[model samples]
Target: MEQDNRTAYFYLFGDNEDFGMKSCWIRNLTKAPEEIEVKLMEKGIPPMLTKEFCKFPEGQESLNKKNLEIVWMEEGDGAALLENGEILCVIPSWGGDRGFCGYARDCNGQGGFAWELSEDNEIRKRINNAISFIKEWNEEVNPFQSLQPQILDYYEDIFGESEKYYAIDNSDWPPKGLYVYEGTEKIVFATVAVSLRPQPKVEMYYEDASKVNRIELGIILKSGLTNDEINNIASLISGITAIPWDYITFVAEGHTVEFETIASEKFKYAVLTNKLKLLPEMNVPAFGNSHTNFLWIVPVSDKEWKMMKESGSKVILDKLDTIGEEIFSLERQEVV
Candidate 1:
């Protein structure tokens, strides 16, 4: 087995940029000096003084007496450098800002992907374990390659010509949702729930159902979306996932169904839970029914839910329509 041959580089910031310093490829922190000297010669400190400065108790006391400060570098912020000097992964400091901590990877120069740390205890523990694994990884072994190659290959294919893919770890913020973006526009917004106890099962649903569906319209109204509009929505979803799969599933009557309808059936739960709200005047008899021209799901936070309740259904529906059009326009421009 060949080793990864990658080195992790750590950095420390001083009181000013002039004193900021970086460490050599750090494989073991315990064996390295705690405080690294920076700009010692440039600061006019003699070579003899530099040698004495590293000489332990007296050196530390002498430096303190001269009002010189020694800054220690830790594993808080670092990057994995490839053998050829290309950066592999960006590592964030532990116990730092929750929003700022996560792993970022470059995908063969096609694009990149980032997974932000969620507040879930299990998820956070997994991230911590990942960091520890990177630190403890011996360069002489190939057992753990840090990241799965299949996952990287999958991202390379999905990103296509796009510049980047950003995914939020949904273990906490949105509960079970995972929202991914291409550039600045949202491409995939899905919520997935998994059951791991007796048997493993996955339930996934899109956040915006209408944008991912195609339907034959029997009646057209001023508020109804055109076929072109519906197609654009489907295109956006396809572009984000880069996977060729049917966004819509039609179940014929008398057919034994093992899976429930994602569009009509499960989406109602999003509404019931205040994650989505439908318009009363849409004239759709029931969600996922044959008569419905389009099925749309809107995500609302607790604060937005309260506001929607007070604003009445008509106002909420209008607001949602406006937002949907804006998002559609953005996606369309990106596609073009």
Candidate 2:
């Protein structure tokens, strides 16, 4: 994908300036000993200018030993041909504030997405996986509909023997309670113990040398998010993990429902990773509802965490305590 000239400059210098000629000057310096005279003629640079700029600084012998090729790119269009005629790989610059990552195709006219490119191939693959998770989320899983008592009971009947039934879908599963499957996508009625499983992780690299990735799916009951939209999300994200559909549960508290699962504590950290813009603060019913916003945890190694930071997911270093645990307390009240 083409990127902006600013993206390229930012990649190289981590900043932008008109005199940003580091990459180019480095290139000319390397060609000095053998091709300096000839190259200066081609660029119309006086031989004296080439000699002065290409001269090795003290303890910088590596400049003479190296070969560098610099290229120019159109603003916002990352495509460029290096002096050696090689096209650099384009990687997206992730903006965490936007909750997504992709390339910046507009630079001021230098052709590169960034200066140092490493593992972007892997990062791109992971970002694609993240998008897939979002798409799948839109397809399956009724965030609200999964909460009815009837639905929870349905799964309970299948697995609640000492509730020895961990496998709710077993053919021998018996319906010991009310079996209700309301057609409304947002509001379901069932007496089963439903569970919400975490979604798969997406790993993508960004220009910051940091990595970007996400786990599970978060559905903010944004305005206009209908019952159908929530259900579609559930269905799409359902089978991405081994956590069975029967284990996923959504609990209703009023006009909205929150999702969770028996395995939630393990992956609850995902909530901290994604920003959740709750509905506009209401003055009447202060706490919003009588329950906590849902959460899920995802186990990742320190290496994975570091890689995640590299992709632009800001490290919550000083605030690990603030994550996983919810601070809200809603007191149940009857709706008139």
Q: State each model's C-alpha RMSD to the native.
A: 19.5, 18.9
Worst 10 residues of 2 by lDDT: 327-336
Tell me the number of clashing residue pairs for each predicted model.
0, 79
Q: All candidates' TM-scores?
A: 0.23, 0.20
Off by over 4 Å in 1: 1-25, 28-31, 40-227, 238-276, 279-336
| TM-score of candidate 1 relative to the true fold | 0.23
lDDT, residue 128, candidate 2: 40
- Give me the overall lDDT of model 1: 0.26
Q: What's the lDDT of the predicted structure labeled candidate 2? A: 0.26
Can you write out model 2's per-residue Cα lDDT over 207-227, one digit (the tens) per residue?
321111111222222123344
